[model samples]
Target: MNAREVMLTIPVVLAPDDTVAAAVHKASASDLDILPVADATGRFLGAVSKADLVRHAHDPDARVGQLDSADILVCHPDHPLERLDHDPMSSVPHRTVVVVDEHGRLCGMVPWVNWAVDEARTQSGHPRSPMEVRTLSMHLHWRCLDCGYLSARAEGTPVRCPHCGAEQSAFALHTED
Candidate 1:
């Protein structure tokens, strides 16, 4: 199935300028790990997690700032979902990526599970657990050789980096336990 066929049509989101308190309310109400952050025009900015706020809860000043990811990790809505790597043990089960338009407008989410289930439905002509349908993700886990930051520019294929641009292949892959 195509990405558009399995994409999440409506996703709850918050504004970038929204306060931590507001974000807390939304996440609590939804009972989800992460919430998408949008701009005034409903353009996706980034994601804010409950853990993110809790990490800074001790610091009373943390909530005063934007409730958005400092460095946003995003994916296209039209991309294939079977290409994601999901760790079931992780707190957030989101192999799904937040999708945005070319102009950066919030569109929808394409979850890895949806792809599997949809594919199973197509191949088997019946519903099958997404877990049973497996697809190995080819994404390279890149890390900054200098500072130890995970490179978010896809798994492989070198490109001019923004962190420490020393050619394209400077950063190496980093996998965490």
Candidate 2:
């Protein structure tokens, strides 16, 4: 599967200008230790770790924009998870990957589990569908608000609109009574 298929929408995000205190509050709502940072128009900037937020929590005025972003891992939506040419995440402490659209807008976050799955698949020389490769055990049907595309995704987690590349806010669970 491609990065887009395996990536998950990071529900909580920080704007570059957000204060360190505010970032700490936002990060608390998420299960991930690292949070993606995006701009007003949804362009990806970087990420701030939970530890970084805590370290700077004493300085509420400190802007998240000041956080060093040189080590963030970046990849396109269509990038194949099966193989990567340049995986700088090998050295990145967070090791989380940020998936971006063609215009460099934030698409979603790829958990390290995907890489582990790839490793097993490669070792076994077995090819499986995205669902088979995914670690999430549950899924639900969803529809993109920006476009009419509908599909199933891991339950409760958001995802980038595969068809129109709309951000997570534009998606809604679809159910029929």
Model number with the top TM-score = 2
Candidate 2 Cα errors over 4 Å, as ranges = 85-94, 113-177
lDDT of each: 0.52, 0.66
Q: In model 1, state the lDDT of residue 88.
A: 42
How many steric clashes between backbone atoms does each model show? 1, 0
Q: TM-scores for all candidates?
A: 0.51, 0.62
What shift in Å separates residue 152 of candidate 1 from its native position after superposition? 32
Cα lDDT tens digits, model 1, 1-177, are 435555565445776655665554454444234567777788776776545654554553455235446323355656554444444445533344666777888787654553443463556465455554444343335544433345643646347556666445444443222
- lDDT (tens digit, per residue) of candidate 2 on 53-160: 766767889999998763446788888765644332343322567889999899998756445446546665866545434333233255554554567655453567
Worst 10 residues of 2 by lDDT: 131-140
Candidate RMSDs in order: 14.2, 12.2
Which parts of model 1 are misplaced by more than 4 Å? 59-73, 83-94, 111-177
Quantify how close model 1 is to the true structure by its C-alpha RMSD in Å: 14.2
